[model samples]
Target: MTRVHDMGGRFGDGAVVPEADGIPQLGDWQARALALTLAAGALGQWNIDVSRHARERLSPADYGRFSYFEKWIAALADLLVETGVLTEEDLSGQEGDAPHPLADRVLKAEAVAAVLARGGPSERPSNVASRFEVGQAVRTLRPAANRLVDGGHTRLPAYAAGARGRIVRKHGSHVLPDSNAHRLGEAPEPLYAVAFPASELWADPEAPGDEVVLDLWQSYLEPA
Candidate 1:
């Protein structure tokens, strides 16, 4: 889907800003949202990729306006209902019979601090070797599909789609997020670091150091 989120090569305002002032990374509500998301994941309901797609599926307007954690919260809220774990009433603080999502393994407040410190892992073993190798020329896949109607997640960004690039490095085979997000199991695939020229994506001057290197899966690329 072509959206503002894919700002790979666009020329920005080029506004210079000061260094970090040490403000909190997340507000109170966002902190709560993160906790809920992590707690839900502990239950084995949905994977990180699914939650990512849920955020990406949001309307463009909402997506552009939402902060990073806001998107996370929205996605978590949606997934809860999608998995039949909770209903609108349950979230609204109304009395309902919806089973506690974490009834089997409740997330204690004290444990929340520890859980967030150690992030969730999603590495799957691969039985097959990677199709493409480092230094190989490749072209990205360009599909006319949107998550809202098409129903899936993709790591391929719009600007990089259909563009040719060279595989700078191979990150080895890992769980294919597209399939994992859909609950189709890991479906391991190769991941590569592809370097695309700035001119190719933005039609701008290809400075000697100006380039976009993105991590893309094997499914998104083909031999050029």
Candidate 2:
């Protein structure tokens, strides 16, 4: 399902602005939000996919209104509560007498650099062969009949639905976000770089010669 956050190929929003060079764009609180998110995620209660889904689940009005980091902080709080790490009272600033539930798992200040350096890797070993080969033509799955309903988190962009493309490269196998976001098993699948002409995706393409390449999974494609 298409949510407000999926802004790909949409018109009239505004021009993209590049961040100023060497200048910090975020405030201290924004930095804290990022740190808190990473720290909470380190506890193993949820994965990156789950956190992304939490942000997407925000109400449309709130999603559109809040600034970027604001959304992150809000989503983080909700996830903490939902996972039983924090209570509603904790969020409301009522200090508790009991010890923190995840105190042992707290990301330590001394190990911050090591944790950041050893980034999370999603690619997993797969014994199954890839379904499509380079130069093979394929098409993305069309959107469901009910477009407004939530269909969980997905990496497929709404604009790319039903679009025709060709496999430009293979990325081996990786965790499928559709299942991972819902706490489902990480069903690894062959990922490919599929290139689609601009004309195929847009009705009135300003630059028809250009192409858009998306890293798509095997399940998202079929013989064209």
Candidate 3:
């Protein structure tokens, strides 16, 4: 089996480009069927009401990949439930109440398939400002009382918080769930990846003359 790393190169946009031959083989009909099934699962998991909505949001290429790896989807669903990202009730009609470990694993695979159908990790919406053009000055929002624990706060990384930066590019809009709690589902918000000079982020006497780009949500900014 070819390692995933051996399969593709990372594009400038952070997307992977699998080698042409690296793509697995599947008939058109089979691929379409898998896409349809995975779309259905996404609707159930995300509480999305319309099947068309799920399909419209997903990529045909990603859908085919999901079809090719059905087992992986089931495993992911199990993991999500085990980790409390989902509930047993979510898997109620899907599978039997077997041992938690086994049931969870099965559900994880199913849920993963749904996520793949929904465009995988990269496709989620964000909330960051696009109002600023390139080279525009912007101020980072101050950290709120409850900071994000999974790393640092959302929209504003600690180094950039309270710091000023230039908007290097516009990454468009995406869903901005409360990063601190990730509750309230998700809401559409503009997204931007601002560039901050390394010297600016760190008070280093001697550091590489490189800049760090942060994917900031719109809510994390005020006028500089």
Candidate 4:
């Protein structure tokens, strides 16, 4: 199902204005939000896909109301509560200054730099072989109806759906977010970088020669 988070290529949405110097002007709370999220993720309660899906699960009103990091903090709170790491009382500041139950796995400050450098790699051994090869013409799977899609969480964007493209590069197998987010097995699939003509994605002639390339999973594409 199309949720509030899937706002790609939609019209009337304001342009994404970048910072003048292209540097992120993050506030203290926003910085804390990122650190808290990474720290909580270190506890191994859930995967990155689950974290993303959790943010998507926020109420439509909340999703729209919250800022970028605000959404992260809000979703992190819900996830912590759901995983029994924190309680409503804890969130409300009613709990005492007791040592955390999972203190053993607490991400230490000393390891932050190392942990950040050694990021969580999702590449895995594929159970199946690659289906499409590099430089193969393909088309993104169109939604059954005019509606975007019915699946809960997906990497496929609504605008890219039903568009014809060519596989420009092969990314090998990786964790499929659609399945992993919903507690399904990794179900690794071959991924490829598909390049589509600008005209196929947009009717205007502003940048017709430009191409939009997306890293798409094998299941999301077919022979065009």
Candidate 5:
């Protein structure tokens, strides 16, 4: 699971460059990529987290070279094939069976803004109490030496794995991506804003005094 995507704090990638170019706008392909991802979601085959994880699973070469929306389109294709909606051959120029779930309505461009503004909410009721609280010190659990997490779908980033941090705030119970990505279940767990000192994650952090905040779930943390 630990791969290039989690190599943010490591070498090779230089200082975080601010967007110095002019105002950005979606190009033709990027716009279509966004629409396709939304259309596939309307089919009810996979959740948002699953789509994101799929993008992360893209081959390192493609994942590194593809533009942002390209990654989304790639993930969309992966999911469509994964859910039996399409096949590799279908993607490879073959005629594919139509998905008729939302046959009557279409996600028109006119309504794209409204639809995206009303984001998919994942909050769920939890009977279980949180084991940690705001201001609590905790450590992210690392997989055993011989065992890497089976995939990159987990909420715990590889850079932050095994490091200690403090819970700055609790965002209440929400669907855990670790389970949601696998379609195992909602697996709602307490979410927190964990703030780690920059030096903890990198040998020579760009900004030594800054803190790297990550939205971590309960399952990823334990007593420091």
Candidate 6:
């Protein structure tokens, strides 16, 4: 029998232990289950709280249903306030037509567009090979299908699978690593693109003769 120590409800290899009564205690698996349930509940509450905040400060037209997975909502709202789209006074108070107080500011269309234009920090790749160049022939690299469940990682979608293309452009010096691999802390490698026939991307495509440009990284392509 393993001696189980209670570390004041914290569970880890070296958690602090609290004095336990003789009652049989739950194991690590049980504790994890409970934690996961609580975390889910907290995430739900967070969405509700943020949504309510949005409705108050934002104009009626600007308010809409928000996604729980949008962690950057607060930051966006803050930017809105900073840009004068909404104000602290607008968010203040919890009465009148609005039930929820505006927790933050609302973003104007121009402000939103500006922010959208500035893409996030570049995630670079680890290993890469400069196998192709502009005006050079190249082919898509068909890798094994990913088995893991998708969430935040990036992978080549099925739509572009087995498609042939040409190197039409190079997006100067970027760390184009596998999105999924990058999420797991892998470095981003250089990336490139090969233009595919529109017919390749879509069967019975209207632009069958036209070339569809793809911004593929180095790892996603090989010499044709």
Residue 82 CA displacement from its true place in model 1, Å: 0.9
lDDT by residue (1-224, candidate 2, tens digit) is 58888888888988778887896767899998989889888898998888998998899999999999999999999999999988899889995789876789888999889999988888999766788999999999888212222577888888999999999999989988888887777888899999999999999988968999999888888889
**Over the stretch 1-224, how does candidate 6's per-residue lDDT look in tens digits?**
10111111222446557876797665665554444433332322223222233333343233334322221344344534554544666657432454333333333445545544653455444455566778887777554223232321224454665677788776644533333332333345656666778777675677657876767766666677
Report the lDDT tens digits of candidate 5 across residue range 93-190.
98756765555566667867887898899878886579898888999888511122365377677788888899999998999787788778787878
Q: By descending TM-score, how would the candidates be arranged?
A: 2, 4, 5, 1, 3, 6
Q: Evaluate model 3: give its lDDT.
A: 0.53
* For model 3, the run of ten residues with the poorest summed lDDT: 1-10
Question: Mind giving the per-residue lDDT tens digits that candidate 4 earns over 1-224?
Answer: 47778787667877778667766777899998998899989998988888998999899999999998999999999999988999999999898888987989989999889889999888899987888877889999876121122456788887788999999999889988888887777878898999999888887736768998999888888899
TM-score of each: 0.83, 0.93, 0.46, 0.90, 0.85, 0.41
Each prediction's number of clashing residue pairs: 0, 0, 27, 2, 0, 15
Clashes of 3: 27
lDDT per residue (tens digit) for residues 40-76 in model 3: 4443344322222233223445444554345334434
Backbone clash pairs for candidate 4 read 1-150, 1-151
Write down the worst ten-residue block by lDDT for model 1: 143-152
Model 6 off-target regions past 4 Å?
1-127, 143-152, 177-182
Sum up the clashes in candidate 6: 15
List runs of model 2 lying over 4 Å from the truth.
144-150
Alpha-carbon local distance difference test for all models: 0.77, 0.86, 0.53, 0.85, 0.79, 0.48
Local error of candidate 4 at residue 99 (angstroms): 4.4
Model 6 scores a TM of 0.41
Best model number under lDDT: 2
Q: Model 3, 85: alpha-carbon shift in Å? A: 8.9
